[model samples]
Target: MAKSTHDHGAAFRAGYVALIGRPNAGKSTLLNRLVGEKIAAVSNKPQTTRFKILGIVNRPEGQIVLVDTPGVHKPGYELNRRMMAAVHDALLGVDLVCLIRDASVSTGHGDRFTLDLVKQSDKPALLLLNKTDNLADKSKLLPLIEWYQQEHSWRAIVPISALKGDQIQELLDEIIEHIPVGEQLFSEDEFTDQPMRVLAAEIVREKILEVTGEEIPYVTAVVTEKWEEVREDFTRIYCAIFVERGSQKKIIIGHGAQRLKQIGIRARRDIEKMLGHRCHLELFVKVEEDWRDKERLLDQLGVGKEG
Candidate 1:
């Protein structure tokens, strides 16, 4: 694989690009694709992302700081409210805003809601019609792109399939072209702004989302209790998954602790792959009744807290 080379003597271009869109619009997927790594938690469930995730894309042309934000939607609980607030906070000081939308679906209120934010922002905006592969015909993309172009004079309008890696390179080239010359904001080896502890928590949370059905995923929060780098290139990661009630805890633990074991094995594999080493992941399910509604709990969990 050809990696982006950096020229320390030459001027580097770096800026923040916020990815905003409705739930399940493939915003997280796009971020992972652009960074050439899985920096954000991806799930088929709506509102899978709940915070302003920073993914660093280092390319030969420039370094792009991609902000994968929570989906903009009506708030149903305290967590939802925090998610929306995070989205708004991410918009501030952004050099560019990439409004992603599902190209296969007809434009609806959710799409308009996202576009409204773009109109209000002074930063350069780009309307990305994502998931183009799902479209029955390629010609249909032209009209949708044109419609959005007429509605708003965006910096650029591009169609891409994040899942299929279609037109993604073109999208990155366009983004780099817009960023002004500057110094590299991050090291070439760095792929994300999030810390290792946070990443570990997210990996476990993603497993919870995968194995557990219904609202269990949303009600649960994962926190890293201890992370110790052991000898022999191995690490010990202890994490706790918080739930709102005993029943939820049972659901997470499952019969004979089979579900918990599943979450652990899957998370451990991903963590090892991410760290490029072996890992011993230990997960515990605890009932922190109504932790979602508790402000202090939310603060401790690193949600709704300013960075």
Candidate 2:
């Protein structure tokens, strides 16, 4: 990462922007695009982001610190409650809010619920109709945009495709324009606030989401128990995959432990890329018996921790 050479004069602007929306609404994807890095994990699964990840974007005019939060959903467990808390915390400490919605899907109660959250925030917000590239009938966007406008007096309504880099620069420009004038909060070289251990655990968890089915991903959590740099170019990592039931553990391990093996291989590749060094990843599956409801474990994992 390089330091910012951008001007920091009277015209400069900077602020935190929260990415809020329902599950699987492309919030993580949009964050990655805006920050120009994969600091946040990406998966098709809903609630893929369990914690709020901050990614810093340095530009000529301003710096945008993006808070990528977990998908908004009803709380059913301690974990869910904490995730929602993270969302609320982000809403309280931000200069702007971005309500990202999947335009391809028909509007429903869930969408309205998300909008209600934005309304309660009472902050300047931009309604981003994401996944516009996936819309088969582009004409339908007009009605969708109209509906959002009618719901709230948005600062701006921009239809975008977070996956395809569509209108990303325009969105950035809009963000910088709306934020208040201020000095940059972080240095240019800083991209994300996530620690390397947390990132490694997230990458391993993302691999679990990618390799397994829906049930496994939601019921599973990965924690990096050990990280050691044995050499300048080689690192060793050990992660524990916690599951709620023994049967689920069997599923993740798979026949002859091949599934777990595959997950290790996939996660190591990304971890190595992130570390810029060779990595030896070790994984172990453990049955935690409904760890999502355990407060101590959640504390250790830093889930729902205050920003």
Candidate 3:
């Protein structure tokens, strides 16, 4: 329950805050809700966020810079190792840590892995029991909160539904309280720090996550090859979707290229909405022979230390 002694309400506050939890625990959804925009791509699939994405929330009184990271999971591949590294790096130099838990489901080993990371951090940690709307019994929340309070002396334990916009403002107020007194970390007009190329890749990857299920989800990665502004009102974007095997590529393309068409159509719409411009998007499928393990390819995709 350790926290700053400064009067946060009396002074302007600004600092970095990280959202960490088990896979599919609604951490990305909660980040989007707090930032008031879809800065992070979310899917029903686990491990959707592959890197640490920064989102800014500017309030009337304080500013919070949210570092949205990949879900906590065991590393079975080089890609998975890079993802876990992002989580460790985000833990450094943060004012507060908000560990979200999927309240609707029973806690398990993955949840324990996240809790252990929290125990190692010296920052003030806040436990957000997200997706409480899915709970059948509202009375179950009290015991849930009490149990977590004993687990870790959190600054606050708040129940919220990030999807249904329930108690969102209350969570924001609690977050502002934990931030220390300082100047604004980012400008008032900015919402996220993600570059255009990375966001395009993420948007395309989100479509892939939604369109394809099974083993295809983990074997896929998107790279934006070209981003050209044809005119002030128009943009032409081309991206390549890399898979480890040719069969995987064929599955993604589908019969008569129907599935690829579907992915492109859905992804283009999201890209247009995000960029606020008319977009012409082209998607191509390629077999990279396990590109995730290749350090050279991963650096190009923005996962290396210098990347």
Candidate 4:
């Protein structure tokens, strides 16, 4: 919550940049890499990020506030609609847009749809072809680069491997150049804007995504109902995992509630790492039929609230 109030001088440039892309495009990976910390929860599942997470990157010359958004996808339920709205919301105030694409895959209708969203933003953009390390032959990327060039006259096109940190400095340099000269918006030490409670919930959800099958992640949501720092080096948390049906709940619980216990163990480890303290995490599952469509539950869950 601390802002950098001192003047950073005329050489400094700081502004918000939206990392817009399709699902599983490695936007969160890039954000974490840029900020040098794991503030956003990452998984291979589509639409893993449901809110606009602000990651502050401090440079000697400037600061970059990266706004990581939910993936661009066809809205189905109310949750999907709210997720898409977060993407649109990110575009409105950003100084630049970095459209992240998975270079290892073939471009399709979804890619085009994402590009359309960038075009609609009417802001200067840089095309970042993420996951380039997945390519065995780097020369094969020329065609994909050319295709994007023909689609839109971008400010710059940079190929980067977010996972392996390839060409990341070049990408950062390009980003710093595009943003206007201004003072720093956030403290240099502050990496992200997410509260501990929201992050705890996301960590539990990420564990669920990691262990469960395809269908469960889309219908599931996690809310941290309680968080208390019980001691100087220990904390206690109680979280609720809401599913749309009893069958889904059963799957999450597993036989003798083993799967749920595994989720808590994994989540607690990450939470302890983040807080630098031992944590007692209790996870409870509940069936909330059609909860995604319920606005009140969504409000309580902080969906679309960051936008």
Residue lDDT tens for model 3, 127-182: 98889899889777777787787788888887889999887878888888888889
**Poorest 10 consecutive residues of model 3 by lDDT?**
1-10
Query: Looking at candidate 1, what is the lDDT of residue 158?
Result: 81
Model 4: per-residue lDDT, tens digit, 181-201? 999999877888888898899
Give the per-residue lDDT digits (tens) of candidate 1, residues 153-250.
88777888999998887788778766778788888888887899898899999988999898797889999999999976999999999999999888
Evaluated against the true structure, the overall lDDT of model 1 is 0.86
Candidate with better lDDT, 2 vs 4: 4
- The whole-model lDDT of each prediction reads 0.86, 0.90, 0.86, 0.91
Model 4: worst 10 consecutive residues (lDDT sum): 1-10
TM-score of 1: 0.93
Please identify model 2 stretches exceeding 4 Å from their true place: 1-10
Candidate 4 regions exceeding 4 Å error are: 1-10
Task: Tell me, by lDDT, which candidate is best.
Answer: 4
lDDT of 2 by residue, 1-307 (tens): 0122333464989999999999999999999889888788899999999888999999888899999999999989999999999999999999999999999999988899989999999999998999989988888898898898889998888888999998887788788878899999999999999999989999999999999987998898889999999999999999999999999999999999999999999999999999999999999999988889999877876777673
- RMSD to the true structure for each prediction, in A, is 3.7, 3.9, 2.5, 4.5
Native-to-model Cα distance after best TM-score fit, residue 304 in candidate 2, in Å: 1.7
